[model samples]
Target: MPDAKQMVECPVAAMLELIGGKWKPVILYFLGSGTRRFGEIAVRIPTISRKVLTQQLKELEHDKLIMRKQYKEIPPRVEYSLTDLGESLSPVLAEMSIWGKKNVLEKR
Candidate 1:
């Protein structure tokens, strides 16, 4: 791990810097389902531009939160899956999902 100073001044701040983006959590959520290809993820997340999606994936890979696999094939094959570190986030995300369903959905 990087030094505390190198990390965004504080642990929490650094954490947010890593996962607190417009699309990262959502990407993590879908990846929680299982491995998926770029196009598959793109189809599921329709609103994100391809450029943004690529950028987010690269960042996640750099953070060691996700793994990208490339395979040789007729065309080309790539898949993304959450790493163990990323899987550790599952419980938190699940709780948040429950909360959203309860507080946000119940009001509607």
Candidate 2:
């Protein structure tokens, strides 16, 4: 657990600290569907730079929300999938998607 001093008292704010960001949520959303390779994730989110994606992935891994698996092969391979905790956010992501389609996409 993080030190109380390090975490904001507000639950939402603290939750945001783990998953909130321009890219983190997006990354999680993609991973929510299934496991993805580094390139696969990059392809889904074209606007994210490789460097930033790497950083965000590391943070999510550190937070225990995602799992990174490496396979021993001639050309090294890594894949990412959500942990149980990460999958727990699926409903939240689903709701957000529905809301976006209704309130944002449909409005336009």
Best by TM-score: 2
Error of 2 at 27 (Å): 0.9
- Each candidate's TM vs. the true structure? 0.85, 0.89
Residue 91 in model 1: lDDT? 82
Cα lDDT, all candidates: 0.92, 0.93
Residue pairs with clashing backbones, model 1: none
Which portions of model 1 show Cα errors greater than 4 Å?
1-10
